[model samples]
Target: MRLLIIAPEQIPVPPPVGGSVENCIYQIAKQIKGNHEVTIVSLYRKHLPRTTRVGRATIIRVDGGSKSNYLRNAIKQVKGNRYDLIQIDNRPSFIRAMKQAFPNTPISVFMHSMTFVSKPVTTPSKAALDLGRANLIIGNSQSLKRTLGSKFPAQKHKVKYVHLGVDLKKFHPSGKSGAKPFHILFAGRLIPRKGIPVLLKAVQIARRSVPSIRLSIAGGTGKPAYKAYLRQTAKSLGIPVTFTGGLSRRQMPVFYRTGSCFVCPSQKHEAFGLVNVEAMASGLPVIASKIGGIPEVVQHGRNGYLVGAYHRPEAFASQIVKLAKQPELTKRLARQARIDAVQRFSWTQTASKLTRIYEGHLNRRQG
Candidate 1:
């Protein structure tokens, strides 16, 4: 099968920066190339070495000014070629353009996260209608599928939930042992939707009970003003918070391994908490908010605790304190987390499932 994948415009293929969507694209493309001809159409923001062959896939960077032009060029490329399937990664603007470009193609739109919840101000009803035109829609979590189903009932049958997978080898437990201060880690874009402020407030309350507690925040700041606000909030509360800006994917394992627990207190709009799976894979218990797809990933009390999404700082603080005081409980949950992460969230399994979806579409088209 010949497959063409369209990624979001933030970065081109072989992205210099780190992102979950980019990483997933790279891994899935590499795997699919073994059996199918894969071509990645991405933005040419930075200089790419003309054309590069990754695994068995050929990555083509298209230069364009506006979103329409990007879609125009992409459709032009496909018009001359015979592709078995077209897969577009999540992006409302790109998806809208692609639908216009390839009206009859067996297109599949993969949702990385909910656009409406991610950006509360923007209404995605029209975008969701555009997405309904696709032959199939793939969501990263059950929560995402339900959300989309409720929003666009006309295309509910087209929406399928396929959980994202993690590379177990790259994100496993480090054997190094030694009890240190209770270190909590948060790795994601520094945005309000991520509930970073909530996590900060929770840390402040937890510190009163466990003074040795420490919080390490990794990831780039999307909104400078919000980042500044977070800093001020931390200072006002007298919480020891360290912001590591951003780290490459290669460096993430170190942070995951060193930390005692991972917290993702996202309020809503989070389709799937990829970091939770990554942390669980690294043998660290997770403390995620009970919202969105978090509960589906983190088994409360089994792998980690799930605090109420709308709870105040005291609630989050109490959970942290409980985990800190109960070393035996933490150890049990962390052990199970490691086992579950490795068994359930393997990239090999995810790629295989995706391959089947592509094959099914191609088979139907041929029939």
Candidate 2:
């Protein structure tokens, strides 16, 4: 089968800068490419080649401007290619044009987040129409699927949930011994929605119980004011917080391996928390908020603990304190997290299931 994936225009495919959606596109394409002919279209970078082939897949980067330009260029580049399936990532702006370009082709629109990151796709009527044109609609989590279904009941039947996957081999336990067992890690954009402030407060509370507790935050900061506020807050609270700006995919493994636990204290609803799975894969116990699709990933006292109430510092602090105190419990959770990651959330499983989805749709189209 020949497949083409239309990705977001802002992020590069293969993710040199590091984005979950970009990583997802690359990983899925890489995994499925062995069995199918895959091609990806993403934002062009001056430093990278315009077109390149990785494994069995081809990547084409185009110069981007407005969403209109992206849509036009994407359709132009992919015009002559005979693809078995077309998958558009997140942006609804490309949908109408792509559908027109490949009239008979089966197109699947994947929604990785709750809302569009692009301004053009945020328009309700246009987004609705663009969404309606897809042959199938896929959400990264069931939580997101529910939200989408509720918002656009007409497309409910088309909506399906396909949980994101992590690269197990790349993210596995280091097996390296003797590191700081109380080191907490948070990786994501330094934004209000990520619940960074909440995490800082939780760390302050946790340190009262476990004095050795520390936090290492890794992610890019678009809002300088917010970043400065976080630093000042950490200082005032006297919580030892280290902010390592924007780690690439390569740098993430080291951070994961070094940290004792992963905390994703997101105040806003996460479509699916990829960090939880990544941490679990790295053999670190995860402590995430019990909201959105996070609960779907981290089971309370099973693989990891979930902070029940939204942004409750004490609740998160208590979990950290418990983990610090009970080495045996932490070991159990970490071990289970690794096992679960391998069994349930590897890229292999994701690829296989996605293959079924594609094949099922293709067969129906043929019949």
Best by TM-score: 2
**Cα error, candidate 1, residue 355 (Å):** 1.7
- Per residue, candidate 1 scores C-alpha lDDT tens digits across 1-367 of 7888987666777666676887888777776635688888877765676467888788777777876777777677666677767888886556656666666668888888877324462556666666766888889989999988888788888888778888788898888666789999999988877888888888888888889999999988867888888889989989899988889888898889988889888876678899999999999999988888888889988999888744577777888898888888878899999999888887777777888887887787788
Off-target runs (Cα >4 Å) in candidate 1 are 45-47, 92-104, 116-125
lDDT of each: 0.81, 0.87
Clashing pairs in 1: none
Tell me, what's the RMSD of every candidate? 2.3, 1.7
TM-scores of the models, in the given order?
Answer: 0.92, 0.96
Model 2 per-residue lDDT tens digits across residues 83-129: 99899998766777887889988889989986773345377666778
Evaluated with lDDT, which candidate comes out highest? 2
What value does the lDDT take at residue 298 in candidate 1? Answer: 94
What's the CA error at residue 340 for candidate 1, in Å?
Answer: 1.1
